[model samples]
Target chain A: MAEIAIILLNMASYVLVLVLVALGLVVVFGMMRVINMAHGELFMLGAYTVVWLQAAGAPFWLAVAAAPVVVGAVGLVIEAALIRHIYRRPLDTILATWGLSIALKQAVVLIWGPASHSVAAPMAAAIGVGDVTYPVYRLLLMAVAVAIIAAVFWIFLRTDFGLVARAVIARPDTAAALGIDTRRIYRASFVIGTALAGLAGALVAPLISVDPQMGLGYLIPAFISIMVGGAGPLAGVLVGGGLVGGTNNLATVWLSPVVAQIVVFLLAIVIIRLRPQGLLGGRDGA
Target chain B: MAPRWLAGVVFMALAAFPLLAADYWTGQLTRYLIFGLFAMSLSLVWGRAGILCFGQAMFFGIGGYVMAACTMGLVGGALTSSYLGLAAAVLAAAGFAALLGYFLFLGRGLSGAYLAIVTLAIAYILEQTLKSAYTLGADNGLSGVPPIDLGLFGASVELWQETPRYYLVLAIVAAVYAALDRLLASPFGVVLTAMHGDPRRLAFFGYHVLSLRLIVFVIGAAVAGLAGALFVAVDEFASPTLIGFGLSTEVLIWVALGGKEMLLAAFLGAIAVRLMESTFAELLGDFWILALGLVFMVSVVLLPRGLIATPLGRLTSGRHRDGT
Candidate 1:
């Protein structure tokens, strides 16, 4: 029972990480219909922001707080400079964002070199969970994930911003005709999505190796989760993250981590095969 | 279409290049020729069929593995022949594409971004799988795969020298270009153009849309596999990067920057980008990526037809325009 409980906790943590990484992507891809290949680069930029701030004598928590702002600003700049121009051409957007991804990665490599950096977890202590003890930092990560999800849900579903954003997504011309600035909505949504990805990166920095290429690892799983979950933000993240993350964690218990990844990919393929619109049955951008 | 006379002239220039260039340059050109072949494969599917495959390296990597396995005698000692290795590489890549396409295109079908994302995922999966597969040398990759050994009857002629190897590669590339050009001008090619233009309309005309897509995908994979096999032969090494996202995106850039609509233009784009990398990557260092990113952005936004293809299209009186 103790082992099972620990496994469940571990699975939850994995699901949270997947959800956090995917939340930003879900917003940008689902709402704007822009396949931002550089989405991972935004995450990488957030991790770098945390690292750079920490190196400059800020506390870990403070650095984490600054990450979303720094990365969000960068995201806005990218949206204005590049993403704004190619919104109509989806395929061209893929190439443009891919170029952005490569450029961001290379810039990081240029600035910090190719070596990996490690960030210390602020809460190093362990907390008792029934019979087993878990790291406080891991527990904090889960709490953060839940808080962010709830926050996003509230903002998108309950707030005026979310209502306008959804309207723009559903019918841009109609939204524009109704006096909503669709362009502003696109820019805002893109920033919010990138900021979420940034926060996720900052939160997870202590647990994984931080490097330019590390974003690719998170990006792939996040993509799998989003695809499996479909385009709907809240339900998609929950179902997709739960399924991909839970299955991967379970596979890790029974098989190798590599095998677990393969299992998740196989599961994604099957999910895509069965539910072409994704498991949650949302409409595709096409 | 480029003037036939211009193509002949260009071929003549390439055929005479070995005579004037240094042996080292000739060797480098050999490698570039293989990349050109890879770019042509991408052009065939992406330009002609409108299927933007972002994970072309998967097929290339499959071919490399098959070539390595066969030449190393890891897969049936009798299959150690270079000819058999090349054949196996093409077949393995095509087979993988057929299976993958069947799953991807059979039902409601995936197009645009969904297809790109799935293909990219599959390529990443293949890279991870190869990295973990100990029999294939894991991350270190397989090395020392023998070069092309053309055995006529009992006697074998190994292409070990620089000039001979260059000539051999050139001959194969020319043959492939000629054959592909002919194939593109056939009735099947017209169907491919129509399919890309309007799949629903083609389906209405009783054409099996899925089968056309699968066939083109398989053909493209086969060409990429052939290129990969040749690459391993020239380099005498095969690594996980051969089948990963990095090379896949690089090839995509090559085809896109060269103008995917024209096979020759795409082929030249690969060579030009590669040559530019060798020169500028050393001088500019990491800033080279920034330049490349700028170029890619500009190409996508301003010159959707490609840098080379735009002028070529105008020069050829828009003959190369495929209604895209």
Candidate 2:
């Protein structure tokens, strides 16, 4: 029973990580219909921001705070320069962003040698939950992930910007006729999604190996989650993340991580086969 | 595609290349020719048929493994024939493609981005599986596969020398290219092109869209597998890299930058990238990749017609056909 509780805690934290990483991917790929292949690199850049800032003696919390701003700015530049022009061509977007990812990764390799950097957790206290004593930072990570998801949900549900963004996503022509400036909405959503990815990277920096190639390890899994969860609805993030992440983590505990990954991919394929449009999708984005 | 006369000239140049070039460069060119063949296969599936097969390297790798196994006598004790190996390699990849395509293109049928994502996942799975299969050398890959051995009635000629190997590869690749070019110009190509433009419209005209899609996919896989098989012989080894995300994406870049729509342009794209890589890889190293990335992005955004294709179009303007 204690082992079960401990396993559940570990799975929760892992699911949170998957959700955090996938937030940006879902927003961009799911909502915008833009295949931003460089998203993982953006996440890498986010982790690097904290790494560099902490290296400069900034507090870990401050570094985390700066991640969104810095990453958002970078995302802005990417949009203005590359993503803005090719919104209609899905295949081109993939190639262009793949190129962007390659460039971004190489830029990091040039800036920092391709070595993994470790960040110390901001807190080390242990809190007892049921029979398991979990690390406080991990518990805090879960809380923070939930808060971010809630904030995103609230934004999409309640805000004027979210309402307009949905309008643009659903019917850009009608939104433009209503003077909605769909272009600006696109730019904003792209930046938000990218910033979210960066924040997720910063959050995971202390737990995972922070390297130029760190984003790649998460890239496919994030993609899997987005695919399994469905990309049309925002809530798909939770559903897909829970399924992919929970299964992976649970299987990791029982089997090997590699096998767990394969299992998740197989699951994703089966699910996709069953529902080509995704579990929660509408209007045939799939 | 290259104009007939221009293609003749290019073939003449290729045939004459080994005389002026070093043996080392000849061997390198052989590999590039195989890559060029691989790029053309992608052009047919992606450019002509509008299928973005992201995990193309999976078929390529499958071919390499089968070829290596057959040629090395790993599969059967007495079946070390290169001819049999190549045939088996092509069949294996095509068979895999048929099975995968039946699921992916049939029923609810994934298209565009969804298809790309699914293919990418499957490729990742195949690569991971290869890495974990300890019997297949567990990521280090199978090595020491012999070169192509040509058997006649009384004697056999081993492609031990660079010149012979290069010529053999050139002949096979040239044959495949010509066949594929003809195919694109046929009524079959017209239907595939129509389907790419609007599958719904084509379906209304009595075309079996699913079968066409599967057939083209299988053809592409067969070509890629042939390239992979030939690669094992030329490289003298088969590794996990051939069947994974890296090569898959690399090939995508080649086809896209070359112009996914043009067969000859795509072929040249792979060769040009290889040439530049060999040159700049030594001087600038990683920065070269950065520059390549920037160029690819700019080309994709601004020159959607393609970077290499844009210029090549001008070169073969009057000579080119709609089939090309």
Candidate 3:
């Protein structure tokens, strides 16, 4: 019974990580209709920012806080320089972002060298729960992920900026005609997505080995989750993350991690085959 | 579209290349010729059929594995013939593509980025699977695959020298290019163009869009498989990286930079970019990636027609329509 509880906890934490990794992609791809292939690289940049800041004698908390800001600023520049030009062309956006992803990855390698780095977990204590003890940091990460998701939902559903952003997403031409400054909305939404990805990366940096290629490991799963979830905002990501992450975790118990990944990927392919709009997506899922 | 005489001229130049270059350069050009064949396969599906396959190396890798298995007598003793190996490689790749295409294009169909992403995922999965499959040599890959042995009813000849191997690969590439050119100029090709221009309209006209897509996908896979088979013979080895994401994207960069709309341009693109890499990689170190990225971005954004294709298209009276 205790083993079951521990497994469930582990699964929940894994699911939360998956959700966090995919959150920014959901916005950029789902909301903006822009396939940001460099989304993973953005996450990497954020983690690197935290590492660099903490390495420079800054407090760990301060480094974590500054990660999103640094990544967001970088995203803003990318949006202005490259993404803006290819917004109308989805295929071109994929290619362009792919190029950006490669450049960013190589740039990271150039700056930091090829060696992997590890960050100390800020809260390095475990709490007893019945027969099993769990890391406090893992639980804290779960809470942070939940909070971030809620914040995003509230912003998109309740805030004025969210409203305008959705308006632009739904009908860019009409929104532009209505004097909504659609371009600014695009820029802001892109930045928000980038910042969220950065935050997720910062939060999880201590959990995994940090390196230039770390982002790529997360990229495939995040893409699968978002794709399975459909391109919708909150509901899509939630359902997609739950299904993919849940299945992946459960499968890990029965199968090897590699086999589990293959199963999850095959499952995703099956889902997309059956429901082209995704599980929770409407007609405009594309 | 590129003037029929140009093909002959290029083939003649390639045929005479060994006479001008040393043995080392000849061997290097053999590998480039194989890559050029791979690029042509991509151009067929991406350029002519309007399906931008992001994971083309998957087919190429599949072909290489099949060829390696057959020639090394890993599959069965009867399949050890190089001729049989090449045939099986093409068949295996096309079969895989056909199966994948059935799932992908049978329903509402995955198009554009969705299709690209799914293909990329599949390629990644295959690469990972191969990496762990110890029977297939895992990360070390399969080595010592014998060179091409043409034995027709007991008369056999092995292409062991660089010049012979280079000429053999060149002839194969030229044949594939010619066949593709003929196919692209046919009535079937006209329908393919129409399908790309507007699939829904073509479907409304009673064309089986899914079947057409599958056919083209299989053909492209077959060609890619042939390239992979030839490549194994040239390199005498096959690794998981041959079928992975990095090589897949590298091919994409080559094709895009050369010009996807024209087979010749894309083929040249692979050769040219590879030549440049050989020259610049030593000088620039890791910065070559940055340069590649910048070139990719610039080509996609500013010159969608590609560096060679854009100028060449204008010169050739713009016969081929621009495609992404």
How large is the i-RMS for each model, in angstroms? Answer: 1.3, 0.9, 1.0
lDDT of 1 by residue, A55-82 (tens): 9999999999999999999999999999
Model 2 C-alpha lDDT per residue in residues A1-286, reported as the tens digit of each score = 8888889989998898888888888888865789988999999999999999999999999999999899999999999998888888777898899999999999999998898899999998888867678788888888998999899888877999999988887888999999998889889999999999899999989998999888888888888788888888888888888998999999988778888899889988888877876677765747
Mark the regions of model 3 whose C-alpha exceeds 4 Å error after superposition: B318-324
Clashing pairs in 2: none
* Candidate 3 per-residue lDDT over residues A13-82, each given as its tens digit: 8888778778888788876678888989899998898899988998887998999999999999999999
The worst-scoring run of ten residues by lDDT in candidate 1 chain A lies at A277-286
Per residue, candidate 3 scores C-alpha lDDT tens digits across B40-154 of 9998898878888889999999999999999999999766889999999999999999999998888688888788888988899899899998999999999998999977665
- For B135-249, candidate 2 gives per-residue lDDT tens digits of 7887899999999999855368789799999999999988988898899889998999999999999999999999999999999999999999999999999989999999999
B273 in model 3: Cα distance from truth in Å? 1.2
Full-model lDDT, candidate 2: 0.89
Off by over 4 Å in 1: A282-286, B318-324
Q: Please report the TM-score between candidate 1 and the true structure.
A: 0.97
In candidate 3 chain B, what residue range of length 10 has the lowest lDDT sum? B315-324
Cα shift from native, residue B164, model 2 (Å): 0.6
Candidate 2 structure, TM-score to reference: 0.97
Residue pairs clashing, model 1: none
TM-score of chain B of 3: 0.96
